[model samples]
Target chain A: MTQYAFYFNGKRCTGCKTCELACKDRYDLTPEISYRKVFEYGGGDWTKDADGFYVPDVFTYYVSVACNHCDDPACTKVCPTGAMHKDADGGLVLVDADRCIGCGYCHMACPYNAPKVDREKGHTVKCDGCAERVAAGQKPICVEACPLRALDFGTKEEMEQAHGDSQVADIAPLPQKEYTHPNLYVDPCKHAQMANEATGKVANILEVM
Target chain B: MDGMLTAFDEITLVLFTTLAPAGALAYVLVALPLIVSGDRLLEEARRRLDRFLCVPVVVAMIGLVASATHLGNPANALYVITGFGRSPLSNEVVCGSVFLSAAGIFWLTSFSEGPGRIGVRGVVVAIISVLGLVFVGVISLAYDASTILTWNTPYTPLTTWLNALSGGPLLAILTMRLARFYTAGHKLGRALVALAALALVASVIVYGLWGSLLPELRNSLASAAELAPLFMPSIGLFALLGIAALVLGFKAATWHGEAPLWLPITSTVLMLVAIFLMRFQFYMIHMTVGVGV
Candidate 1:
C-alpha cells in the first residue's frame, strides 16, 4: 500500500499561487473550477502593552491545498457511482470522469473540498495527484511549479521520514486532521495556531479562489 | 460559509425531494385506511381511493422528472441503482423505482370494472400500500449521510416522516373531496383532519427541537449559526399556514350540510405552499462539515 501524500512547508510559502495557476492551466479549467485551491490562513491585530507601545501581532501564511488523496477519503465513500475513487496502484484519489453522474455528492462529501462538478463536462473533477506523472517518477505539476520550494509530494513514508516531526496538521481555517486522515503534512508557521486561537477564521478567503 | 452549496442544491433537487416523499406518503396514508375500513365504509372508501390513486402516481412522475433534471447526464440515471448495497443515493433510486412501479401496477388493477374483483383489488392495494410506506422510510433515510453535518442528524429522517404523516392526510382528504366522496358529516373525513392537525403540531415541535440541538453536533460547521435567523421565520410561517389549513379543513369536513368545496381547496392549497416553502428552506440550509463554514 504505497499511499501518496502532500507535504507543505508553511514557513517558506509566499502565497504566490503559482501552484493554483499551474493546476488550472494543466486542466484548462473554467474560471469557477480549480483542481487545486491555495488557502491563505492569516489573522491577528496590533495591541497596546502596559507601557502604551503598540505591538504588532498580525501574521499570514499560505496553505496550498488540493486533494489530500486521504487514507480514508470521504468523497469516495459517498460517491454513488464509484466515480470519485482511489487509484489502484499508488492509492491516490482520482475521479473516473466517464462514470461520474455529476450529482455533486462527492463534492459535498469531501471535507477538503477536493472534487468540483465541471458543469460543462457534466462530471465531478479533482486532482489525481498527477498519477501519470507520478507513475513515471515525476513530481505533480503543483509541486514542480512552486517557486518557494514549499510543496512536496511522494509516498507517505518518504514524506513522513522527511517532515514527519510536525506531528499535527491541525491548523484552523482548515478542519481537524482527524476528520479525514488527510495525506497532508504541514510545517505550520509560529502564528498558524492563531487561526484557532484569535478568531478561528480563515483570513484570506477573498484572495484564495 | 460562502461555499455551503454547489450547483446541486437547485430548484429541481428541492422539488424532487419534496414531491417524492409527499407523493409516496399520500398513497400510503390514504390507501392504508381504506384497505382496512371493513364493510361499513369499505365500498365508499374503495370508490374514493380508486378515483384518487392516480394523483400520487402523477405526482411521483413529476418528481421523477424533477430528479432527472438534477442529473448532469440523466441518460446515465438508469444505472444509478447499480450501487444499491453501498450508496444511499442508489438505494433511494431503487426505493423510488419500486414505489412507482408498485403504485402504477396498483393504479391499473384498481380500475377494473367488475364489483366481484373488488376483493382481489383490495388485497393487491393493501400490499402495495404497505410498500408505499417502505418507500417513505427509504426516502427519509436517504439524506442521513455522515458528510453533510446539517443533514446527517437523526432529526433529518424524523422531519421527513413527520412531513409525510402530516401532509399525507391533507392531500388524501383533498383528493376525496375533489372526487365528491366527502359525504355530509363523514366521521372518517373529520378524523383525517384531526389526525393531520396532531401530526402537524408534532412536526412543529420536532422541528424546533432539531433546530435547537443542531449546534451541539460534533464536526458541524458554525455556518448554520447565522442561518437560524434566516430559517426561523419561514418555519414559523409554515406552522401558521399548516395550523390554519387544518382548522379550516376540520370545519369544512364536519359541516352539517354539503361542505363548500372552496374551504378544503383553499386549505389544501395553503398547506402545499407551506410544504414547498419548508423544503426550499431545507435546501437553503445545506452546510457540510469543515468546508462550508
Candidate 2:
C-alpha cells in the first residue's frame, strides 16, 4: 500500500555504469540487458570563458534512467497479450510469461527503450526495481550499488522530500515524442540546442519517397 | 567442398538480412479482413447481421491462418486474448470479433427480411468498417522491429488502415455492379469513388515526401531509376492506371459503363503495389540507431 518513485540526478552522475552492472549481475543478465542505463552527452554551445577547446564545447552531464512506472503506462496499452500488467498501488509494470504471447508490442511502444528483448525466450525483460528485494525491506540492487549517491527510491512524497529541492529536477521528464505524453520528466538541460542543430542538419537532406 | 560452404554462406546471409523484410507479410493482415466482410459492403443489402457473409468465410479464415505465421509459438497464440486488457492487439481481437459478429448477424438475416432487416443493414456495415480499420491500426503498431523506420511512425497505421477503407468499398461496388443491384445508386458511387481516389492521391504524396523518403539522402525514392524503371513510360503507366480508375468510375456512375470489377480493382491493385514497393524500398534505404557500427 506504499507509493514508490524513482529519481535521477544529472549533476552528481559521473557517467559510470556501476549501478547498471550491479543490477544486471543481480538479475544474472547478459550485456545490453541492464535495467538501468547512464546516457552521456559530450558537446554543447561553448562559453567564451571556458577552459579548453578540445573538451566538450559547453557542458558534460550524465543522466541515469529506469522505468517511471507511470500511472498510465503506454507499455500496458500496447501489450497485445495479457503478459504485461501493472501493480495499481505502486505503479509497477510487470510481465507474466505464462500469459505472454510474445507479440513485442510493448517493446515497440515504450519511448525510453526500457524493455530489453530476451531474444532466446522471445520475450522482454526490464527493471522491475527489484520489487522482490524492495519488498524485503532492501533497496533495489541498482540503488544500493550506486557509488555516486545519484539514485533514490521511496514513497512519492519521500522522493519529493528527498531530492525535490535540488536545482536539477524537471519533475522527471523522460525523452518522448510529441504524439504521446510520457510520465517521466527531464530536468531542463541544453539538449534543445543540440537537438535543434541535429534537426537543422536533417532538414537540408531532402526526403524522397 | 568450398563451393558448398560458399552456397551455405550465401543462404545464411540472405536469410539473416531478410529476417526484417519478412516483416512485410503484415500487409496481408489488413487485406484478408476485407475479403471476409467485403461482399456485404458492395451489395447494399444493408444490415449488420447480413454483412458477416461479405468477408467470405474462407477469406476471414485465411486471416486467421495468415496471422499465425507472425507468431513465434502457434499454440500459445490463445494467450493473445488475455493481453487485450493492456494491448491494442487485444483491441484488434475485440474489434475483429465485433466486425465478424456484425457480419454473422447479416448472414443470419438473409433467410428472412422485413423492415427491421432493412434498418439494421446500413448500421452494421458502417460500424464493421470502422472496427475492421481499427484492427489494422493495432496490427501496424504491433510489429516490433525498429530498424524499419517506414513502419515505425503512425504513417504505417494510417496507410494500412486506408488500405481496407479504399480497397473494400472498391471490391464491394464491383461485386454489386456485377450482381446488378443498382449499385449505391450512380451519383453516390461516383462521389464515393472520387472521394476515395482523392484520398489515395493525397496519402501517396504525403507518404512519398514525409515517411518513405530516406532523410539522409537528397533523393532516395524520387530518383529516376527508383521511381520508374521504364524511364518516362513508368509515369505514363501510373497516370494511365490512375486516370482509368477515375474516368471509368465517373462513367459507371453516370450513364452505362463497365461493371465495377475492372476499374476500382485495377486502381486498388496499382495503388497497393506502389505503396508496398514504396515500403520495400523504404526498408532498403532506412538507417536505424547504429548503422555504421
Candidate 3:
C-alpha cells in the first residue's frame, strides 16, 4: 500500500518553466498540452503599520505542478468507461487510452485539471507519474530537468524524510488540498501563506502560459 | 474563469443535455395517460399511443446519437456498462437505454389489429413511463460532483426534474395533434396542462431562489453569475409559454375541433423552444474548481 508523492521547493523555484517544456518533450505533447506547468504565484499590499510607517506585505514564487495522483481521485470516480484508473503498483493515476470514450468526464471531475482530452489522439491523456521511467529506475523527466533541483519525488515517507512535513504546505492560487488529498508536498517560500488563502484568485495567469 | 468557451463546450453537448430529457419527458407524458385510461377508452388509447409513441422514441434516439458524437470513440461506448458500479454516468446511460428499448417494444406491439391484452400493455407502459422519469432524475443527479461547484447546487437536479414535468405535457399535446386524435379540453388534457403550468411556475420560483444565493456563494466557488442572463430569460419564457399553452390547449379542448389546429401547436413550440434555450445555456456554464482557472 505504498504511495508515491511529489516534493516542490517553492523557495528555490524561479518559474523557469523548463519542467513544462521537458514534460511536453518527453510526452511529445502538442502546443496545447503540457503535462507539467510552472505557476508564478504572487500577491500583496502596502499597509500602514501602528508605527505610522508603510509596510509591504507582498510576495511572489513559482509552483511547478502536474497530476497529484490523488488518494481519492475524482476523475476515476466519474469516468463512465473505467478508462481513468489508479495504477496498482504505485497508486499512480493512469488512463486506459483504449477504454476512454473521450467523453471528457475525467477532465470535468478533476480538481487539479490533470486530464486533458487529446482531440487528435481521440482520448484523454495525463501524467502517469512517469510509470515507465520510474519502473526503469529513472526519475520523472521533470525532476531530472529541474535546474535548481527544486523538485523531488519518491515514496511518501521517503519524501517526508528528505524534505520536511507536507501537511502544512500551502501554494496559493492552487485549490485547497483537502478536496483531493493530492500526493503533492510543497515547501513554502519564506513568506508564510496558508492553504485556502486567496481561495478563488489565481496569482499567476501570465506565467502559466 | 476564461471568458471564451471552446466549440465543444458551446454546441456539441447541447443536443444531449437538451434533447435527451425532452424526449424522455415526452415519452413518459404520452404513455402515462394511456396506461391510466378506463377499459372503454383503452382500445382507442392503444391505437393512439401506438400511432404517436414513435415520435418521442425518435426524439430520444436523435439525442442518444448526439451524445455518442461527443464521445472520443463511439465504437467503444457499448462497454459503458463495464464501469456500472463505479460511475453514475454508466448508470445513467444504462437507464436511458432500458427506457428506450422498453418504449420501442411497446410501440411495436401497438401495431397489432386486435387489443393484444390491454391490461398487460397498460401495465408494461406504466412501468416503462415511470422508468423514463427516473432516468431523467438520474441524469440530473449525475452532474453533482464536488469539483464543479456550480453544478453541484440543488438547482441542477431541480431544474432537470421540473423541466421534464413542465415540458413533457407540451410535447405530448403537440404529439397528440400530430396523431390527429382530438384531446383538447378532456379531463386528462386539462389535468396535464395544469400539471405543466404548476411545474413551470415552481421551476421559476426555484430558479429565482437559487439565483439569489449566488452572490454569497460567489466567494465559495459555487456562484455562476456569468450564466444569469442566459438562464433568467428562459425562466420567464417558460412561465409565459406555460400559461399561454395551457390556455390554448384548454380552449381547444372545449371547442371540440372548432379551434384552429395551430393554437396548441404554436404554444407547445414556444415552450419547447424555451426549454432548449435553457439547456443550451446550461452546458455553456460548466465551470470547474482548481488549477485550470
Candidate 4:
C-alpha cells in the first residue's frame, strides 16, 4: 500500500492553530470535538555555549496532530462488526456507519485517542485523511490551510524527499501497541530521550507495517 | 452510618447501579406477575390480567426504591430523560413508566360486564407487559464507553440482552415454583421454568466462553481484574451446576410425564443463585475506558 505521511516542521511552526481550524472545518465538527489538535509547549536550557547576550533559551513549538492512519490500527481489531476499515492506498481507517451498532468499542480502543462518538448520530467520528479530496488531486484541507506550510501531506517517500527524514521523530505512544503500525511520523527534537513505558523505548518512526 | 450504607465497592456499586432497575423489573414486573399468577392459579384471561398488572405496577414503584439505592443524585436524574431518543437509559425510563401505568389501569378495570375471562384488554396488557421487558433489555445496553475493548464491543450489548432474558425468566420461574407448590394445571409454569433454565444455560455458556473470551480478556484495560477473582466462582463449579440443572430438568420432564413443578422450582432457585453470581462477575469483568490502573 502507498503509505502517506504528515510532515511537520517544529522549528518553523508558530502554533497559530490554522491547521486545527482547517481540519475541524473540513470534518464539519460540532463544538467540543476536534479532529486535529495543536499542542504548545516551551523549552529552554540557558546553554553555556552562547555569550552573555541574554539569548532566551526558551524553545516553544506547536504540534499539529490528527490520525496517522496507521498500518496497524488498534481501533479495527476491537470493532465487533467491521465498522472500521483502512483505505487501500495509504490505509486510512474509515468507519462504515451501516454496520456500526453504536457500541463505542472503537472509541475505547484507539490509544491515540483519535475516535469520538457523535451522540446525535449514535455512531462515531474519526479522521479519514480527507481521502476523497486527496484522490481528486487536491491537498488535504489542513495541509492547504497551513499558512506557514507546516502541515504537508503526500506519499511517504515524496514527503520524505521534499522535507527530508530529519523532520518526523518516531513512534506514536500507545497504551499497548498498534499491531497496525501507523504511517504517521513525528520528528520530536527530544525524540532520543523520550521513552514510552508501554513500548519500553523511544518511539520508532521508521517502523512500516 | 450513611457512609457504610452508601459506600458500595466498585463491583457492588456497578451492579446495584444497574441491577436495582434491572432486578426491580424482574421482581416487580416479570417475576411478580408469575408469582401472582401462581398464587391465584387463574387460567382465565381476566383474573390473569388482574394478577399480571399487579407486577408491572409494583415494579414501577419498586423502581423508585431500587433507584434510591443507586446513590446517585436524585436531582441530576431529572436530566436522565434528556438523552431519550438515543440512550437506552432514556428509553427504559419512558417504557418502564408507560408500561407500569398501563398495567395499573388494566388491573384496576374489574370487567364485570365482559363475557371472556381476560378479554381483549387482558391480552393487550399482557402483551405490553412482555414488550416492556424487551425494552428493558435495550436500556441494559446503555453503558457507553470509548475504550473498554471487551465490554464496549458489540458482543457486550448482545450479552447484556441475553443476560436479561436468561436471568429475568429464571427468577420468574423460581418465584412461581415457590408460590404454586406443583398444583394441578401447572403445565404452563413447568414449561416456562424449563425454558428459563435452558436460556440461562445457553446464554451463560456462550457469553462466558465465546463472548468474553481470553483474547478480549487479555486486551482489556480495566479495573475489573482486581475485583473479578474476588467474586467470580470457579468456571468448573458453575459448569457442573449448569450441567446438573439441564440433566435433572430433562429427566424430570421425561420420567414424570408432567413436570412435578417442584423439580423445576428447585432448579429455578439454583439458577437464580447462579445467575446472580454471574451478574457480580459481569460487573467485575468490565473494563473502564483508559482506566487500566
Candidate 5:
C-alpha cells in the first residue's frame, strides 16, 4: 500500500487560513465544523535587563493541519460500529456513514480534532484526503489554493523526496509523533516549538473552533 | 469551564451513566432477601417483594431509553451489537442488555409461578445480580480511553463503581419500604446501610484525588482544571447529599416499628442526585492528550 501524507512548510505559511477556507468551501461545511485548521501558536513575554531596558522574547508560528490519516488512528480504534476505518489501498482513514450510529466516539477519541459528528447529516464527517481528486491525479483543493505554496500532498515517498528526510511530524499545538504516528510532515519555521514544549498555546482558538 | 457547554450537549449520556448502573445494582440488592431466604421467606412477603421488582426494572429501562437518544440515528443502533467484543461501548451495551433481559424475564416469570418455585427464582436472581455488577464494570471501562488523560486513570472506574455502590442500597431500601417489607433492625438492613456509608466515603476520597490530578493534565487547547473548574464544589455538594442520605438510611435501619414511608424514598432521591452530579463532572472534565475537546 502506498501511504499518503501531507507536507507543510511552516516557514512559508503566513497563517492566512486560505487552506482552511478552501477545504471548507470544497466541502460546504457549516460554520461549526472545519476539516482543516490553521493553529496559531504564540507565547513568551518581555524581560527587564539590568540597564532598565525592556527586551522582548516573544515568538509565533502557524501549523496547518488536517486528518493526517494516522497509521494507528484513535478514532477508528474507538468507533463501535467499525464505521471509521483506514483504507488498505491508500492508507487514508475514512468513515462509512451508512454504518455509523453517530455516537461521537470518533470525535471524542481523535487527538487532532479531525472527525466531527454532523447531527444534521447523522454521521461523522472528516477529510478523506480528497480521495477522488487524488485518484484523478490532482492535488487537494487546500494544497492547490494556498497562495504561498506551503501545503503539499503526495505519497509518503514523494513527500520525503521533495522535502527533506529531517522533516518531522512533531511540533507545538500537535501531540507527540509517537501518539498516533501521523502521516503529516512539517518543515518547521524558526519559531517552531517541539510538541512537548509548554511555552506556547493555540492563539487562534476562536477561528479554529 | 469552557467545556461545560460541550458536556451539556451530552445530557442524554450523563443521564444514562447516572441512572443505569445504580438502578441495575439496586435490582440485585432488592432481590437479596428472596435469594438468601428462598423457602424461609413468608409467602406474603415473597409476593410483595416480587411485585416491587418492577421499580428497579423501570429505572434501568428509562436509563437505557435515554442512552439510545444520544445516537444521532437510532435506526442504525442494531449495528452496535456487531462490534460486541471489539468495542468498549459495544461491550457495555451488550452487558446492559443481558442484565436487563434477565431481570425483565425474572419479573415476568414471578407472575406465573407460586412460592414453590423458590429454588428457580433464587438461581435466576443470583445470575442477574452477577450480570448487573458486570454491566457496571463494563460501563466504567467504556470511558477509559488512553487518549483521554482525565478519564483514562484507574480513578475513573473506581469512582464510577463507588457511585453505584453508594446509590444502589438507598434505592433498594426505597423499593423494600414501598413494598411494606419490614427491615428495621434486620441483618440485611444494617448491611445495606453499612455498605452505602463506606461507598460514599470512598467516592469522596477518589473524587478528591482525581481533582488534585486535573491541574497537571493539559494539552495545547486547555487544561483539565480549566475544563472542570467546578470540580471541588461538585464533590462538596455530592458529599453533602451523601451524608443526608446516609443519615436517613441509618434512621430507617434502626427504627423499632415500620420505618416512615418517606424516609427511604427521600434518601434514594438524594443519593441519585449526588451520583448525577459526579457523572456530570465526569463529562465536564473531558480532556484529550492533544487538541480534541
Candidate 6:
C-alpha cells in the first residue's frame, strides 16, 4: 500500500503550460476539460514613500496543479454513488466509470477543481495519476514533458526523503494543507505565499477554469 | 462570474430543490385534515379530498423527474442506494423515495373501497406526513458539505425548512379548493394562513442574516459577494411576491363564502415562483473553501 506523490519545484516553473498541454494531448481531452492546470497567482499594490516616490510591491508566481490524491479527499466523501474511490494498491484516487451517475458532487467537493463532469462522456473524469505509465516504471506524461524538470513523481516516502519533509504541501491559491493532507510536495519560489495568506488572487482564472 | 456558470450548469438541480421540498410539505398539509379529524368531515368531502390528492403527488413526481434529468447517466442511478446512510445525497434520495412510495400507495388505496375506513386511512396519512417532513430535512442536509463555505451553515437547513413552510400551505390551499373542501372561514384554513404568514416573515429575517454572512465567505478563486452580486435585489423580489401571496391566502381563508378558484391558484403560483427565485440565488452563491469554483 505505497502512496504515490507529486513534487513540484515552483522556482523552476515558468508558467509555460507545457505540462498542461502535454497531459491534454496524452488524454485527448476536450476544450472544457483539463487534467492539469497552471494557475498564475499575483497580488500587491504600490505604496508611496515619505519622499512622494511611488514604490511597487506586486508579486506573481505560477502554481501547476492536478489532483494531489489527498489522504482525506473531499470528493470521495460526498460522492453519492461511491464511484469515486481511493485505490488501495497504489493509494491513487480513481473513478469507477461504470458506477458514476455524474451528479457533479465530486466536482463541487474537490478543492483543487480536478474532477469534471463530461456530459458527453456521461461521467465524471479526472487524472488517475497516469497509472499505466507508473505501472510501466515510467513517469507521468506531464512530468516527462516538463522541459525545466519542475515536476517529479514517485512514492510518497521517496519524495519526502529527497526534498525534505517540511515543504511537503502548502502554497497560496490552495487551501490549508490540514484540510486534505495532499500528497503533492512543493519547493516554494521566492514570491510564493503561504496557504493561509489572503492577499493574492488567482490571476489567470480564465485559463485555469 | 464563474458562479453564474456553475449555477446555470446545475439549473435542473435548482428546479429540483425548489419544487420537491415544497411539494412534499404541501402533500402533508393537504392530508392534515384527514389525519387529524377524518370522522368529522362529510363522506362526500372526504372522497373528493382523497381523489384530489393526485395534484400534490404529481407536483412531487415532476420534481423527482427533473432531478433525474440532471444526472449525466440516469442508468446508474440505482447504484446510489449503495451509499445510503453514508452520503447525504444518498440519504436524501432514499428518503424522497420512501416518502413518494408511501404517498403513491396511499393515493392508490384511496381509489378503492370508498376511501377505506377512517381510522386506517388517518394512520396511513400520518405516516406519510412524517415521511414527507423527513424528506424535506434530508434535502436540506444534502448541501451541508463542509467544503462549501456558502452552504455549510445552520442557515442552509433553516432557510430550507422555512421555504417549505412558506410555500407549502398555499399549495395545500390550492389543492383544497380544487377538491371543493370549502375551508373558507374555517379554523383550519385560518391556521394555515397564519402559519404561512409567520414562516414568510421568519424566512425574510433568516435570509437577511444569511446575506450578511456572505461578504465574509471568500477563497482564492471567488468570494460570496462576487458569486451573488444581486443578493439584496433578489431578496427584495422574494419579499414582494411573498407578501402578495400572503395577502391572497388571507383573503381566501377569510372569505365569506366559497372562495373563487383563481384566488388560491394564483397565490400558490406566486409562492412557488418566489421559492424558485431564492433557490436560484442559492445556486448562484456557491463558493468553495478553495479553488473549487
Best by lDDT: 6
In candidate 3, which residue ranges exceed 4 Å CA deviation? A48-55, A168-170, A206-209, B1-10, B182-184, B216-223, B226-255, B258-262
Please, what are the lDDT tens digits per residue for candidate 6 over residues A27-117?
Answer: 9998889999999999999999999999999999998999999898888999999999999988888999999999999898788889999
lDDT of 4 at B8: 32
Compared with the true structure, what per-residue lDDT tens digits does model 1 show for residues A1-209?
78888998888888888999998898788777778877766557899999999998887666778888888777877777777778877889888777778888777777677887777788888889988898899999999999998999998889999886654356766667766788888898777772234344455544443
- Interface RMSD, candidates in the order listed: 2.6, 8.3, 3.0, 11.4, 0.9, 0.8
Clashes of 5: 0
DockQ per model, Cα: 0.49, 0.16, 0.58, 0.05, 0.77, 0.83
Task: Encode model 4's per-residue lDDT on A26-71: one tens digit a residue.
Answer: 7778765777666543334555545656554554445566776766
Highest DockQ model number: 6
For each predicted model, how many residue pairs clash, with residues at least 3 apart or on different chains? 0, 25, 3, 18, 0, 0
Task: Sort the candidates on DockQ, descending order.
Answer: 6, 5, 3, 1, 2, 4
Better of 4 and 6 by DockQ: 6
Candidates 1 and 3 compared by TM-score, better number:
3
Best by TM-score: 6
Point out where model 1 deviates above 4 Å: A45-57, A194-198, A206-209, B1-8, B38-45, B116-119, B182-184, B212-222, B255-262
Residue-level lDDT tens digits of model 6 in B156-234: 9998899899988888888887887875347777788888889999998998998888778888877898888888788
lDDT of each: 0.73, 0.48, 0.73, 0.51, 0.87, 0.88
lDDT of candidate 3 at residue A209, scale 0 to 100: 31
- Candidate 1 TM-score for chain A: 0.92
Q: Please give, as one word, the docking class of candidate 6.
A: high
Question: What is the Cα-based lDDT of residue A169 in candidate 1?
Answer: 59
lDDT of 3 at A179: 74
Tell me the lDDT of model 1 at A156.
82
Q: Is the docking of candidate 1 incorrect, acceptable, medium or high quality?
A: acceptable
Clash list (residue pairs), candidate 1:
none
Return the candidate ranking by TM-score, descending: 6, 5, 3, 1, 2, 4
Candidate ranking under lDDT, highest first, comes to 6, 5, 3, 1, 4, 2
